[model samples]
Target: MARDPNEPMPDGSGCALQEPFALQVLGADMEPEFPDKCVVIIEPTEFCRSGMYVFAEVEGVRWFRQYLRDEQGRERLVALNDIFPAIELNGLDWKVLGVIIQRNIRRKIKTYEYADGPSNQPHGSINAVDITAS
Candidate 1:
């Protein structure tokens, strides 16, 4: 997909030197974690800190999951949903498409589709995706 030449990325992120990736969201598999209809900005060059929300491609599928590293010094990918779908580093070669740097959400009282979307709503905060690099 082509971004408008005048369109600006958050924090002065530019598309000139970077190849922008566009992926259609499938469903609520990653909600409370990310807004349902919001466009996810996957910043590949940004340093992915532990606990940061990340966009990854695994087994030919693209998804947004919390980049997790357990105490064993292992890199793992986990879904925020209670189901907690986990991807271990042993066999699956997870590709970090980029880090979820920004999201656009539209709601009157703020409702999320992930585990963190809203408490009254609990299922967590749509803006609760952790981005702090380790």
Candidate 2:
């Protein structure tokens, strides 16, 4: 496991001992899927595979991005939103801290339901419903 460069020396506070952790998505780099403020569950011990969502260290900086292999078989980090440029892996000191296994959407999910009773109803209008409970 790669230690955080800015982390203070362990003083037996036991802050490091824990299970799967959660991180809040903070930018538009991973939008449409991992929207801003959404909580993601990270499993540190899970085996990471290609195209997995992971938090990694790149040149002493922690970055949350999707892990992928480029056409030339190079490991690269990509942002879901195309507005951000992909980070290419090269001489940087990088390590996968964990893979995202689940996401807790803090925003509302829009769902459509039939407004009228469905007894073989034809062309019924749909009512928009927002499911916000997490």
Q: What is the C-alpha RMSD of each candidate to the true structure, in Å?
A: 10.1, 12.2
Residue lDDT tens for model 1, 1-134: 98777966666355653665534445676766454565665566533545666787778886687766555778777776656567775578567767665554442222222332213422123344434333
Model 1 stretches with alpha carbons more than 4 Å out? 1-24, 107-134
Best by TM-score: 2
lDDT of 2 by residue, 1-134 (tens): 98887998784345554467878889888887778888877776434555667888888898888777544778888898989998988666788888666667744454333333333322223344545675
Q: What is the alpha-carbon lDDT for the whole of candidate 2?
A: 0.69
Best by lDDT: 2
TM-score of each candidate? 0.57, 0.65
